[model samples]
Target chain A: MKLEMKDSPGQLVAALTPISEYGGNIIAVIHQREPESPSDTLGVQIVLEIAQERLDALVAAIKVQGVSILRLGEERLLYRQSVIMIGHLIHTDIGDTIGRIDATGFAEVAELNVHMPAIAEPSTALITIKATTRSEMGRALDILRSVAAEKGLLIVEPLAGAEA
Target chain B: MRVAVLGLGAVGKGLLRMLAAKPEIGLVLTAVADSSSACIDPAGLDPAAILDTKCVTGRCGPSGLTASDVIDSGAYDVLVELTPTNAVTGEPALTHIRSALERGKHVVTSNKGPIAADHAGLAALAEDAGVALRYEATVGGAIPVIHAIRDGLAGNRFSSITGVLNGTCNYILTRMDDEGLTYEQALAEARELGYAEADPTYDVRGIDAAIKLVILANTCWNLGVTLDDIAITGIDGLTVDALRLAADQDCTIRLIGEVVPAENLLRVAPRVLPRNHPLVIEGTLNAVMLSTDMAGEVTLMGKGAGSVETASALIGDLIAIRDRYVECG
Candidate 1:
């Protein structure tokens, strides 16, 4: 199960409570995010084994805890969005910047690659985000714009060229 | 299920405390065996008297409480072995453990010497007798490295494992680098802090890490690599200047244990890692980094030592075994 949980303390524990209450054994948890982002939401991929009868109760319990269930089946990486950031990424604390983008409710920054020439020079970061839907992707970009404005950085939304 | 703790040392006391706290686990403490007579009480007769009359019931005379006594008594469904590390003279504990397993009882231990030296033989015995030989606390103290590799990451083809296997050595190095202490000063501090043993050779000479590496290599890569195959290096010879130099270059000097298999060469070594590396940030804590072709790199980090942490891992293995028994039966 892939879940998008509110990026807050004890949210992971709250989300897992129902699984344990329903007698679900969590085999593995895969969570990766940019370290510097505090508000950045996290994508949790859990592999669990529970009875078929308890599956509905488990999902209901998670929903009660306000956790967004993104994908229910075996499919991994159900949603993906790519964005480009242009500005002084290194000067503005790249880790914290990534955290802000991830802290948004709609998306998580899964991958980021930055190019910086000098300590004081502006750099560009190619960030790939994962979200539940296209609307969530737009909301994530809005959060990124606010963060960029506050950090004196620039955000360049990806443009799709006309089809041939 | 009733259980008996054979040694009331650090690990033994920790196990007692953990088992006592878990209400879901129907554990009854029936007996205890310790070499020290100073801890035993003869008046109350019940072993619980010594534990403030909380859980333990009967008291065995001493460490001489043989396997036959524990098995024939039929008071315990499981035997916990937390004796000191002595592969040569510790055969009695091994004997008791084997007997327990053969008699259809479960066994949990934190003794690395026996497991490193004779895991195969004991595993076969446990399988034949339809019992469990759980030793999660033996390696990496409390990090769950053994279980994570054996079960959680079992699906992946483990290509290599690199870690700072010894907490004492890591502590010594961390102090030397951070505080500018000399090797002797750091060793003295470690001894004072109870991190290093009185002799300290096992931890300082790299043999400790080698044993852990050998176990991981055997389990993960199926290489059967022994302590002799590992190129062991200690932090004894390193100077403060070298550590400072490494720190200046965006790297930290750590005693890393690595098991790498590429093409024909299988390698295990203790090397330095950059500061940004996850293992470097692990600091005094124990961390194991595993690399696989499919999973890329996965690192598990947590407390490497301490009685409670190690005992918790043992309890986790015990619960898993119990659940499996319930499923199978």
Candidate 2:
């Protein structure tokens, strides 16, 4: 689960209370305090296991705490895919491209490597993203494709079922 | 995090000092044991007083309580196995770690006996119990070679591994090269400087290096190799003339542990390496050359063995376990 909430005291505990109330076994919680966006909000990524029947109730309970549920699933993000992009990454704003996928909360940019030969010339970047499920992985790829198309960057996506 | 240390040797005391130095980390040494006795406190104990008592009284814990009792007391969150290495039987240390894992406690060990003898078995046990059995200090002391292979170079295919594994042997070989001393003369000098043990069969006979190789082989390549599988040769036979001959050729003789997974070969023997070779590290410094497909040859060099150095590795493992617990929660 990915959560975005205002950075305030008791925000984390308020967010976690729903998991316990809904009988979800939390496997991990990656809480980032420093705001990474315009909104002064923290991103909390939680890995958990819960019954499908109780998910709706859990979501409702979490929403009651004024927490924006960016992503919620049965398991943690595990599937990984790497894509190579060649274009004016910095001038075209690669940060916006990554933000689009990351905001979806279905996938995260796990690793990135860039080769900037010159300031004016086109640069190359290798980005590795991880998602929770196979269907989510396909959606992440579609999101990347749209972003790359909008940015006029050539993308080399990972082959089907080849993503680590 | 609560901890139970099994040995009160130099490494164990060094670990206590490190833990005591960082009181804000919330890691408490709740239990400690020497071979003679054991001590336990649900709350944290005063490490300085414990050291003082051990030093002045020559007893680690109260009478009659063994290391096993401290382990099974259910007082510690992780078991710190610092007992001496017994490569033959993997003894008391093996049992200590096993008992901790069986009870669902994580383990961090510097003892190479259990890892060299049954790394696979112990790893399987830890997996079965959903805990960690980390022995980063068992091989390269403070170099973090195991962490480098398992975590830092994750997903890379390791082609080969070569290392100056034993510090005592490296010291003796360095002395022989610098002073043009004979094998026995170098060995005696190393003993006098407290570099080699009084009974230096393990270091001089290549057994220690071979054991470290077995640990690395089993970890990196999943090769279920043992001490018997390694082709061992020591520095005992290298004379001063050989050293001079290598020097004349711009080379130096050093005990090298090589592991080639492609050929299914692992050996610990003296090799005449060029002066510029990464393995030509001088004195007691150890270096491991990890030949990987992606990262190429990554050379990790550091102090191979010392109380504080080995304690640094142990503290790294402990903190890793602590972070794992924080994540798993």
Candidate 3:
């Protein structure tokens, strides 16, 4: 879960109360102090496991404390597929491409390999993307295709009927 | 499962004996090669009878089949590499490993040259081919140090690793310390006992220990380091006087391999350790001490090398692969 809250002494405690009240087990909480970007709120990411029935009440309780929930999802990634991308990978903002898929909280770029021959030549990379299900894999590939098309990159996907 | 073995040395034959002894493990020897020739049989060979014939004839196989031909035969699902160590080129061993992985065959090896030379590259190739490359015997003979670090302490990060890796060096040094013998006298005794090789440069010059250190460091830290990165000092220059002086100081001289990834330092040299130091192993025993975050300091010790001891590690890897394949299926 990613959230935004006012940078105050008791803001973190206030944001975490709902999780405890809803019987959610907190795994870890990452709260890095950085200057406010465009909004006057702090960004925090919390990893936790909670019962499905209490999720609605948990979200409601957090909003009662004026915390903005930026992202929230359960962990379910299972299947993985490895693909290769060839072109000006570095110049095309590879980080942004990965972020777009990861933002969904259902897929992630699990592994990566890149090769660059010269300063002006195109680069090649072997990428492994993992997802929660077969349909999520299709969504991830569709997102990758759009990103690659926008950057004029060539993609060599995993062979059909291949096991990962 | 079908298995092919390359390099029919002592360890190779030992592995065959163990496989024959435990046929329930489901590994069948389909091919085997010596230095000059190879024998291929998809239906499997009688391990005891073959050992007897090779012992009497001085070699095995049909005179002309090479290592490459055995790989190309495509009769096995796994390749066990028991070739000699060539730290300089990692030659035929490296080539053979690459060929097997490219053909999508799992590999279990006791050879350290290929691992010390190009482990990261081979690991990448194995990943691409979707096969497993296991080399537990490349380090401590039967200690299972690799699995201890990679699996048992999977959640912990290591601060440093120190070990007594070469048994031959340890045997020579132990004799020098206990019997007050000179380096030459102890080395001669080691050779007489078959502990030291005829040309003991690799063991005495610290190259063998250094190679094992490289393999462990690369695997543990994913450093992609080569042998040239380490600073090595062997026991060739240590004299009896130094050993006596260490004894006076309540310390014994032992060759130690130390790696500190945080400082990007790897060194192997004769160091004076207190008599009680965990790494101060006696005789041919090998020990590795890993300083971990969650588990404190974990030390593992066992026989470092022998035909049967090394075969134990090879068979352990084979079983691990088989179990994983079953789980995945």
- Give per-residue CA lDDT, model 1, range B76-146, as digits (tens): 66678777877334466777777788888788888776676666777789889888888888778888888
Using Cα atoms, each model's DockQ against the true complex is: 0.01, 0.01, 0.01
Give, for candidate 1 chain B, the lowest lDDT window spanning 10 residues: B37-46
Give the per-residue lDDT of model 1 (tens digit) for A28-120. Answer: 988766476345577788887665557888999999998989899742223565544656777778888778766764468898766554566
Worst 10 residues of 3 chain A by lDDT: A155-164
Model 2 iRMSD vs. native: 23.0
Judge candidate 2 at residue B325 and give its lDDT: 76
Tens digit of per-residue lDDT, candidate 3, span B94-203? 99999999999999999999999999999999999989999999999999999998888998999999899999989888999999897899999999999998999999
Clashes of each: 7, 0, 0
TM-score of 2: 0.66
Give the chain B TM-score achieved by candidate 1: 0.86
What value does the TM-score of chain B take for model 3?
0.97
Residue A29 lDDT (model 1): 86
Worst 10 residues of 2 chain B by lDDT: B240-249
DockQ of 1: 0.01
Worst 10 residues of 3 chain B by lDDT: B240-249
Q: How does each model score on TM-score? A: 0.60, 0.66, 0.66
A140: Cα error in model 2, Å: 58
